[model samples]
Target: MSAKVPASPRFAYKGDRLKPLRAFCQTARLGSISRAAEALFLSQPAVTLQLQALEREFGARLLERSGRRISLTREGQELYELARPLVEGLDGLDGAFRERVRGLDAGELNVAAGSSTILYLLPKIVEAFRATHPEVRLTLHNVTGAGGLDLLRSDAVDLAVGSMLDVPADLSYEPVYRFEPMLITPRNHPLAQKAELELQDLSPYGLILPPQRLTTYRLVDLVFQQNRVPYTVALEVGGWEVIKQYVAMGLGISIVTSICLTEADRERLATRSLARYFPSRSYGVVVRKGKYLSPHARAFTELIRPALFEREDYYANGQSER
Candidate 1:
């Protein structure tokens, strides 16, 4: 006969107490007992009681009330800082658990990307992933490259995809592709007839440039700075698509990545190689250090890795072998 085994001690009550802690944190964060109550679906008195209980447990006043307003005490501020992540992590855990119960892969994969990735790459990548794992939902946060990296560090996003320039040391990156930048102008523009172009050659025309913070803008700036080329920037826009649209309208000449130009753009505009060598920008996948990746996210990464880089090399090398 098998020996009888002792059952584990009950820990459910301890875990369930997070509900009160969550309510207290929300009230502290929002600085209004009524607002916090509404947010947590509890009465004002209930939220007040929870806050009082938390303060009692810590043996200090956590909040101070003045008329209709509330503010955190010094100790409360510290506790609030600590509690915010705990609450967020618990929420993430709840989401992961629900997904698991629904016969789907658990955990969320938050992706941060720029407008270029959203417009050009993300749709195809997301579609392909969803076809195989229809139930795995992906959340995309679109921001500038710098902002994307900030989100990744803050745990707002699991991964970021874009140009790899000025990446932070705490993150890891895998190169996806290297794209050549091209100068685009209206079909009737004088430079359209040129076989090749340089920034100095295009100095006579107004240039529609991206904002200073964007990787594209930095790439263009580096080239001009290195070559000592002087030109007039007619406009500075935020996104590639917008820049292309402005260029198409004969607004001004603009430099853009070759991949950002579509067939429609080609038909409407003329593109020329820079007379001097402009450095190609490497777009890559970026993830935070030591963060957990869901199985579905890992699979998606595997799919994108080959689709973006390896297969192209295989075919190119194969043709050369022939």
Candidate 2:
């Protein structure tokens, strides 16, 4: 019997066993193994293996895959409901505690913003912030409108800076900058010759629009609908740069934020400020409702709006930062 002592298991997971659940939760929240890996600073294979471990431990498939998209299964949803808050709380605990114990000298700040804002808006502000606080790590997520808001909900990002046409109930938007809208056309276009362009003037010409689901298309739809104007769509493209290129090639004219009109863009196309036709779009910071802000987040946000962090005694009041 003394010779029959049981051998220890060949494999072992020593550190926090909850890690598999944490990786699984981030995968569920972001719906992509690659993205979850990026968020966790782990290899994609590591995240995939952790997910496999979770599914094997529970004896169920936790995820479902479409053509290119991954979604949570019913079992996955149930687990996520219980696991998301735990993972967020555990990961956020360090930043929250450190900021309270010390100050803005340390901590991490992650931000999400749309492509237009990343390309045209954030360079200088981010440079200024980094110059002031090189110790604080800053990451800017270049995501689309819908994707950025989704990242905000999962606590993957501390703050999101972009334009919002429709604000969700669970999110708060604070406008910081207003930019005029401009119509872009080839210099030879008949409409481009007009000193003043009207809604009716656009009816006959082909219009290049962003995809229908995006807010850009929605705003264009609203303006045309209000004026009872009928328009033709020549093409539906994704980025402002591509749209500009097509317009330059004489595909069709497109409306864009004036903030994107660089001198280089100006030489290729003519622009007329359409402020009279469309209200200036606002770009601002958005945060989750009832969320806590780390000192790093507060310091960076205060840079965006001096009044934003001034009123909130984040430690004492803890009143909603929204």
Predicted model with the maximum lDDT: 2
My TM-score estimates for the predictions, one after another, are 0.65, 0.62
Clashes of each: 0, 0
lDDT (10s digit) by residue, model 1, range 82-151: 9889988887997877765663344456788877877866666787888877776788888875788789
Candidate 1: global Cα-lDDT? Answer: 0.74
Off by over 4 Å in 1: 1-107, 306-322
The residue-by-residue lDDT of candidate 2 on 1-322, one tens digit each, is 3578788543233256678878888888788999989998999998888888778767799999976778999999999999988888888999988865664355678899988888867776787788888888899999977899899999999999988888999999989866677788897788777865788898888989999988878888899899899998999989998999999999998888766666576467877666767777787889999998887787777676543233223211111110
**Ten residues in sequence with the least summed lDDT for candidate 1:** 313-322
Q: How many pairs of residues in model 1 come into backbone collision?
A: 0
lDDT of 2: 0.80
